[model samples]
Target: METTSSVADIQMVTFLLGSEEYGVDVMDVREIVDITDVTKVANAPSHVEGVIDLRGSIVPIVSLKKRFGLPEAAAGDYNCIAVMDFAGALTGFVIDEVTDVIRVARRDILPPLELGSEPWMEGILSLGPRLIVVMNLKHLA
Candidate 1:
């Protein structure tokens, strides 16, 4: 059996969704860009708003808000799309704003609880005054 190498530390891109803070590994992030010109896809899931032509490739966008069943944002609410490499394909996730790029040590991340938390959540990072939900979207994708 192959043993997995442990991540001693990781840098993350933190962002806001509703009032909660969320993060994903910075290496998974391709780019952060403003949301615009999303072409709606018919018969797709509600969380999947549509796809966008990023440079030349067509990448699908998913709303973390709708995916998590959070209340919809107000009309004209400011949002940015985090283009992330999930599994292998690039997908865009909508977030309120980019908070900060933080480096989290392995000691600071609590193992994800099975109850009341989504399976996609890898761990919860507790550092100083900030508690962030760190997502492992590879499982979901």
Candidate 2:
């Protein structure tokens, strides 16, 4: 029997924000949960949706739409929170939808272009007809 060596690849969790598809390192993702009631915080940033109790631990949630300056999601829209470790802290990003977890070869990821400055964008990936924008959570936090 012959065995093939595994190729070096990066696993990413893709999600939707508005009409755009974005991805983050799968290792940084903790879990995904349905949208729940978030207690509003006082004097918080515009992107901050509020805080939620996650198994007794309070976690702050950020709205990806607001963070990206996109139009607000319609009320009653189905959404979810993608919990990820940002700067050693657990935070959740409210997204339009959780798409799929895909593995792509390291060579497939390309550097971001200078089409306006996006500090959170780390790279870009082309998967067939889909173009995913890889995000750096460190910059977002």
Candidate 3:
């Protein structure tokens, strides 16, 4: 069996989604901000939570959990918005908490195993003792 390497090998920003660890390519992330009140929009998609006044322009927010069909995270706890610019669109993703910025090299990344009924997991990447699930945020948008 191939062993999982250290988190240092993955070049990414690690964050918590409930108890599971997730990562995204560092270049995609723009900034992190604490959770703030978002103005709800009418007739918006179900996955779209709302939009926030990010500086001068309104940035749309998406519930990552909802997008992935995961349970909604409870309020009044550690919450953050990871802002990313993808394909000329600026969107924010709500996460449980921001963890660390580590570098996991491409060599350490493993292909997705053929599970009988795995959900929409992007792929697997080494992160210390455990394998972190890489999420495809572009698909979420």
Candidate 4:
């Protein structure tokens, strides 16, 4: 069977975080869930919002805004939790909105080196007039 590695493209799940567009490898995403109540954990990392009971499993939730030191999403803005497997663990990250699932060609993706040292950025892809930031999800874990 032909695989993603055998192909010239990668499928990415795009989402919004504070007006910025970000994308991650779709294969790593477990599911996307509506925003849920999170029980705050004491002494947890600053970026960690808290934990949520997903079915019978407890999943830790991290706020991308907080992790990146960005301003919080304004009140009444819709948010969702992106459950992805990263850094050897399954973590849920809060996102502003899910935009699309796109097949990005390797030739269309530019290495982050062009933008200098941005540890959290994996690659950059331009879609018409919009520039999509492909993120290194592993860094969030």
In terms of TM-score, the best-performing candidate is: 2
Overall local distance difference test of candidate 3: 0.78
Flag regions of model 3 displaced more than 4 Å: 1-10, 116-121
Local error of candidate 4 at residue 16 (angstroms): 0.5
Once superposed on the true structure, which residue ranges of model 4 sit more than 4 Å away at CA? 1-6, 75-78, 113-116
Model 3 residue 135 lDDT score: 64
Scored by lDDT, the top model is 2
Q: How many backbone clashes does candidate 1 have?
A: 0
Would you list the C-alpha lDDT of every candidate in the order shown? 0.88, 0.89, 0.78, 0.86
Which 10 residues in a row give candidate 4 its minimum summed lDDT? Answer: 112-121
Q: What TM-score would you give candidate 1 relative to the actual structure?
A: 0.90
How many backbone clashes does every candidate have? 0, 0, 9, 0
lDDT of 1 by residue, 37-83 (tens): 78999999999989999999999999889999899898568488999
TM values, all candidates: 0.90, 0.91, 0.82, 0.88
**Model 1 ranges off by over 4 Å:** 1-7
Per-residue lDDT for 100 in model 2?
A: 94
lDDT tens digits, residues 1-141, model 3?
556775446468888877878888888899998999989999998888999999987999988777767878766664899998755688888889878887766666676688732444568876568678876656644
Residue 25 lDDT in candidate 4: 91
In model 3, the worst 10-residue window by lDDT is 114-123
* Candidate numbers sorted by lDDT from highest down: 2, 1, 4, 3
